[model samples]
Target chain A: MNLTLKVWRQKNSKSAGKLVDYQVSDISPDMSFLEMFDVLNEQLINKGEEPIVFDHDCREGICGMCSMFINGRPHGPKQGITTCQLHMRSFKDGDTIVVEPWRAAAFPVIKDLATDRSSFDRIIASGGFISVNTGNAQDANALPIPKRQADAAFEAAACIACGACVATCKNASAMLFVSAKISQLALLPQGQPERYRRVQSMVAQMDAEGFGNCTNTRACEAECPKGISLENIARMNRDYYAAKFASEEEV
Target chain B: MSSFGKAFSSSIGKKLVVGITGLFLILFLIVHCFINSLIFLNDGGETFNLGAEFMAGNWPIRAGEIVLFLGLIIHIVQTARLTYENRKARPVKYAAYNGSANSKWYSRSMGLLGTLLLIFLIVHLANFWVVSRFTGIPTHDVNNRENLFAVMVETFQNPWIVLLYVLSMVSLCYHLLHGFASAFQTMGWNHKKYAKLIISVGIWYSIIISVLFAAMPIAIYTGLIN
Candidate 1:
């Protein structure tokens, strides 16, 4: 199979960029999207042209590193699937795919389709963790958390810190991503100590990093490879308000 | 503290200002609507005439107008400031993209609609109040009541002006619908069991106010409920 690719190329963060078209031939239907890109890079290298650069580590879907806006939807046509997991069979022989780097003020283009997603790292650093003391590993049965609560926590934890939610959101809001991190921690007993502070800090950081406010539009969830629920956002809001009260009480 | 300092000191403080100012503007709408609804009271002559009389000359009414003007200024200024802050906070990417379909339409476009509503308000005040007060137009009725109903009738008679009014009303409805629920949310009123119900009620109220306000001019123009 052959495919026409329109890929966004940028020399650096400060440089302007545009979509450049490329043609690839002899693509195997079973090849993963990244593998197909590998084939294209090989062709580019053979022709002495600069190879398109994109972020991908561990071709497996768990890393959340492969970020591409294929056609228009993030991670291509499949729902709840990462770009690395997408196969070339999803397209036809003569498909013209428009690929672009994630265009968020928070995430600037580094080169080609790779973007600097360090803003997400900053938001996490603001407060995406618990400050519990280090100790011997506790028995799994010691906490005895409710099954429903445990399940919900696991679901929230499924967020791979992928910026797909940010990339797909119309307002480029990171509420969904930030909310997922907050919700996962808030749902657990171990995370209870810092729940309020976590949400407030993360949200403040998100806003500080120039992410848009959430209008409760669930587009982030729709495009999220992790299928993170919008309810997580509401939970974050609930926690933020509660945290405000908790902090005041502490003061 | 400076006025700017007061607003920027905290998120909650900013939200409080926006909410109070927003509710104040909403109060003006309720009063304005009640007065206009008097057009349907007593054959479109007696009640409207009396209402306009009070609005134009009554000392108490004059005091109310002064208070109302303060509310309008506060609401517009705070809203503008909040919008500016929100814009600055927004990420540059996906700025042109659409949000989730589940979000309220008004939530995303409030700034645009609010601007249009402001423009309409200026036109409304200029065409009726300013013209009647300063130009010495014969705008009063037999009892020396300001004939606001006549002004409304004349304004709606022009199809182009009526079209503008309709568009403005539609935008107002959009603004109110989102603004209503968002006000409650900012005040931390998120009891899920009742949150959805309250938001639905907000939507209904918005629709009713918009329909009633928009209907008045259309009805008068068509001579339906005269």
Candidate 2:
């Protein structure tokens, strides 16, 4: 299949960017979206032109390293999958695809389709961890956590930190990603010790990063490759407010 | 300011303020709609005048009016700030965005709906509220109550005014359609067992309240309630 690609190109975050169109022929349907880009980059090298730059590490979906807003979607038109998992078959033979970087002030465009997502790292560093020393994996029967609570925690933990939530949110809010991180710990027994402090600090970091607020549109959940729920946002709100009012600690 | 006061100024905290004030406005709509619906009694505006007079004269209701306006101001101010920051969050706009693919148009257009409602509210208050409270309506009911009902009848006589009310109510409906359950979600009151119920009730309430409010102007203009 042959396709037309309108890919964004920029020298760096400080420079202006524009869509530069390219044509590729003899593309296979089974080639992943990134693979198609690889083919395009190979062609650009043959012609001594700059190859299109984008982020991708694990060809598999779990790495959360691949970031592409393809055809007006975070990962692509398909739901619950990353760009690397998107195959060329999703489009028609002569389809024109628009590929852009994640558009958020917090995730500034680094080069081409790549962005600096270190803002997420700062939020995590603020307090998205369990400090307790569990010497070994507790015996399965020792902790006795309710099955329902454990399942909910697991669901919240599925967030890949791909910044799709921010990219899709009209406000560029990181609430879904932040709330998912908060909920993943807030629901578990091991996460209880610093639970209140965790929410307060992480939310502060999220706000400091210049991300916007959630308006409950649920666009994040809709475009999420991991199928993360918006319920985690509500849970985070609950805990954040509870910590503010109930805790006496300065944090 | 206390830490509590400081916390309330955060992004989530500001959203909490918007949600709480929005819910308060929702309650105000219920009261306003109910009193206006009394005009349907069609007793030469007697019952509607009495309800309007009670609302105007009762000290507690008068005091509540101040709180109502405070909620309105806070809601508007907080929303303005949020909208500004939200816009700034994406300094560079997307060349192509398919927002409809993920969220409802009304949900994304809350700011637009709200600005329309604010303009409508100012015009509406000028028509009835100012006339009743300060400017003084030309005629009173037989019981000598402030004749707000008469003002409503005179106001709706203009077809353009009627059209404006109808259009405003449509904006109100779309605003509440997103605001109702959205307020609950922002407050962290949403639950798996009741989230669906909240959304359903929100849809019905939005339709019913807006229809009732819109019906008044149309009913008066058509001589159905005069």
Candidate 3:
């Protein structure tokens, strides 16, 4: 399938960007979105033109490394799938596709469509973990976690840190991403020791990173490839409130 | 500021303030709607006048009015701050954003809707609140209470004011549609068992309350409630 692409291009982060149109012919319908980009890059190399730049790793969709706001969606017009998982067949022949990088103050553009997502790393470093000593592993049955709680935690853990929640949020809120990280540990026995501190610290870092607040629009949940629930956000809010108002620990 | 104050001043804390005040305003809407509906009794404003008198003269209700205004101020101020920061969060706008694909238009338009509602509130207060409290209503009912019912009838006579009321109620309807369920979520009150229930209740409540408020003016203008 042949298509017209209006992809945003920039020399570097300091420079301004604009949509540069490119025409690709003889594209296979079976090629993933990134694969189509590969074909385009091959053509650009043949012509000695600079190819478009984007982020992608683990093309299988789990890495959350692939970031593209294609045709107004985080993942190229599909639900619950990364851009790498999107196939060319989702579009018709001759369709004009618009590709742009994630827009958020916290996630600055590194180059063309690739962004610096290290802010997420900082938030995780702030908390987003269970403090376990480097020692012998305990018996699996030592901590009996309820199946329901385990399932919920697993669901929260499914977040890939793709930044789609922030990308798609009108407010550029990272609450969904932050909440998922908080909830993944908050629901488990191993996570209880630093549960309150984890939420407080992570949320503080999230705010310090200049991410916006959640307005309960639920766009994050809708655009999430992992289908992270807004319930995680509510859980985080509950934990944060408990930490501030109910926890015996002094600030 | 202390850590305690800082906590409440954070992003989530500011939202908590907005949500709490929004819920308080929602409660105020219920009380306001109920008292306004007394006009439907059509007993020549006797019952409505007494209700208005009680609302005006009662000590506790008078005190509650102060709290309500405080809630309103906090809600507006916090929302303004959130909106400003939210806008700044995305310094560059998307070249192609199909927001409707993932979220409701009204949900994304909360700032616009809230602004319209604020304008409506100012006009509404100028028409009724200021007259009733400070300037005083000129007419009186048989019970010697300020004839607020007569004031309502005269206010609705102006077609422009009626149109403004209807349009404002429309804004209020959309505002509450998102605000109601959003308040619950922000307060960490959402549960799977009741999440859907909360959304449905929000829809009905938004429609019912806005319709009731809007209908009062139309009813008065048409002489249905006189």
**Using DockQ as the measure, which candidate wins?**
3
The candidate with the higher DockQ, 1 or 2, is 2
Can you give the lDDT of residue B24 in candidate 1? 72
Which runs in model 1 stand beyond 4 Å of their true positions? A26-31, A87-93, A249-251, B1-31, B48-107, B128-146, B181-192
- If you score just chain A, what TM-score does every candidate get? 0.96, 0.97, 0.98
DockQ of each: 0.22, 0.80, 0.82
lDDT of 2 by residue, A1-251 (tens): 99999999999999999999999999999999999999999999999999888989988999898999888889999999999999999999999999899999999999999999999999999999989665887677877789899999999998989999999999999999999999999998889989989999999899999999889988999999999998888888998888888787557
Instruction: Please state what fraction of the native interface contacts candidate 2 reproduces.
Output: 0.66
Poorest 10 consecutive residues of model 1 chain B by lDDT?
B93-102
TM-score result, candidate 3: 0.98
Q: What lDDT is obtained when candidate 3 is compared to the true structure?
A: 0.93
lDDT tens readout by residue for model 1, B117-156 = 9999998888777866687556666666667667777777
- Candidate 3 stretches greater than 4 Å from native: none
Interface RMSD per candidate (angstroms): 4.9, 0.8, 0.9
TM-score (chain B) of candidate 3: 0.97
lDDT, candidate 3, A1-251, per-residue tens? 98999999988889999989999999999999999999999999899998878899999989999999999989979999999999999999999999999999999998899999999999999988877789998998999999999999999999999999999999999999999999999999989999999999999899999999899999999999999999999999999899988886543
What are the lDDT figures for the candidates, one per model? 0.76, 0.92, 0.93
lDDT tens per residue, model 2, B1-226: 5669857978889999999999999999999999889998899889888888889879999999999999999999999999999998988888878898999999999999999999999999999878888888898778987777878888899999999999999999999999999999998887899899999999999999999999999999999887
